[model samples]
Target: MTATLIFLLLFLLGLFLALRPLLGPKEPFPEPPRREELLEELEVLKREVEALEGEEKKLALARMVELERALEGYRPPEPRPFNPLPVALVLGAVVLLGVGLWRYTLPRLPGETTVTARAEARELKALSDKAKKTGAVEDLLAWGRKAFELGVYEQAAEAYMEVLKKDPRNVEAVRRVGILLFLSGRPEEARLFLEIAQHAEPMAAEGWLFLGNLYFQEGRYQEAIAAWERYLEMGGEARERVQGLIAMARAQAQGGKDGKSVYQARCAACHGARGEGGVGPRLQGNPILKAKEAVREIVLQGRGTMPAVPLAPEELSALLDYLDSL
Candidate 1:
């Protein structure tokens, strides 16, 4: 409202300036102050000169002639009224320009943020349609990128997941999908995707940041510290925040911890939410729970399709106790 008022004031001001000159006195130049005095004197001399004769008349007549010449020199030109046609044309043009500028070039009616967001929404929809129609990795990536930039996590995840289906090795898709998952509170799934992305592209600072956060949530304090340190080394923007997280993680490392919580954080994502099994075999009532040493060895060393899961002594002990309970 304030912006509209300001624009209106400026528009009115422009019209005022444009019309001011035409509204002024009709004469282009002002009459000189001395010209009126000269004219009055000339009129008086003319009336008196007619009554005179001889030398007196001759002197008076000469004086009258001199006054007439002076009057001629002082004569003001006729004032010309400003032409209405030109004034009207100029006014029409100015009004049209001001209206057009207000509608197009000036600040929008609502707010710039609203205007920009609406534009983004339209572009996001276009990109999403194109991606769905083509099913191409590039198009999907473009859509995902737009959605991610706009903070629409669900749409971003949909697009990136589509890209991953087409190209499993797409690092950006893996990383972005992981970020979306984390934001949606699916930390376990997020961890899997994030791990893949971070390994494929170690230099990505944002990936490391989330990776650190995932580790922190999982009670893997040492790993969290390392990941956050790497993020800082890579020139992450949230230096102070990451440093604080690292300090907190360090504090957590020294504090007492929970075994079930550790297992859920470290193993539940792949194994099972409740040990019923998914990617890895079922651990619930499994014979492996009775063989603690063998399970520990398998966890520490790569076996079959499973990768090594290195853990600090305390976290490893906690995980083992939790696994036995399973």
Candidate 2:
């Protein structure tokens, strides 16, 4: 409303300026020639009367009266000055139109639009910076979560990282960062942080499950199985499905020829070829039969201290086949 008033005032001012020249005083037109002609006739009659005798004087007087009556019947045109109001109004309207055009049309130009957009962007940036500096941890976290929800991974990661730094033991922050890292192709780093969080708070089933998935990604089938089993032991509820996975792995391990060979090439790298523990858990015994579901789940997922390995389905199948045979 205020903006509208200002625009109206400006338009009025422009109109007034345009019309001012027309408002000044104007000169009146000259009187008609009839008046001057009548005056000259009267002077001629006076001279004739002066020259006439008594009878001639009476006749002259009668002629003068007739002339006066004729003169009275002959009306002179009234003198008039030109009115400037109409011209002033036209000029004022033109000025108003020009001002209206300028105000409404100028901002639509590409350059002006670009400038306006840039200014808006700068203002937003300033507000964001201010919020980051002054807002509370919870507020920042909420904002970060909102960004994450919007699929702005980089912004979400930054927010989660800050939260982690501020409160290393924050389970939610740790989990969020881990997920972000995993999605960003940093599964190894994600696994590390997730494991730390799980160890810090073992009761968190989601953390354990996520850890198990990471171990599985790393090809530590036995470890993956172990983590999942632990999650279950801690009251995780996916028992039937987990058991089914365990049965499949055992059958494959028993049937495949490369079981021992694959184990030597891959499994030995961590757990040693002979089923003895090295960088990872021991593989010997019916640990598969004993901890079958647990082992499969752990290998399929991942656990603390292990990074996720990008294994193809066939490779995972073969590796599981080998672990089962062992």
Best by TM-score: 1
Model 1 misplaced stretches (Cα beyond 4 Å): 1-113, 257-326
At residue 230, give the lDDT of candidate 2: 74
Error of 2 at 189 (Å): 1.3
Q: What does the lDDT come to for candidate 2?
A: 0.66
Location of the lowest summed lDDT over 10 successive residues in candidate 1: 105-114
Candidate 2, position 169, lDDT: 78
Clashes of each: 0, 26
| Candidate 2: tens digits of C-alpha lDDT, residues 1-326 | 34446667776776776666657556487544476677687789888788888988998888888778767777855655767776667677767766665554433322233445445444434544654886656755775676566556776788778777777778777877887787788888999878777777535665667676677666556566677777777776777766565554444433433446455655578887677778987776645536655755666677787554445566666667667666
Which structure among the candidates has the greatest lDDT?
1
The TM-score between candidate 1 and the true structure equals 0.45
In candidate 1 the C-alpha lDDT for residue 24 amounts to: 72
Clashing pairs in 1: none
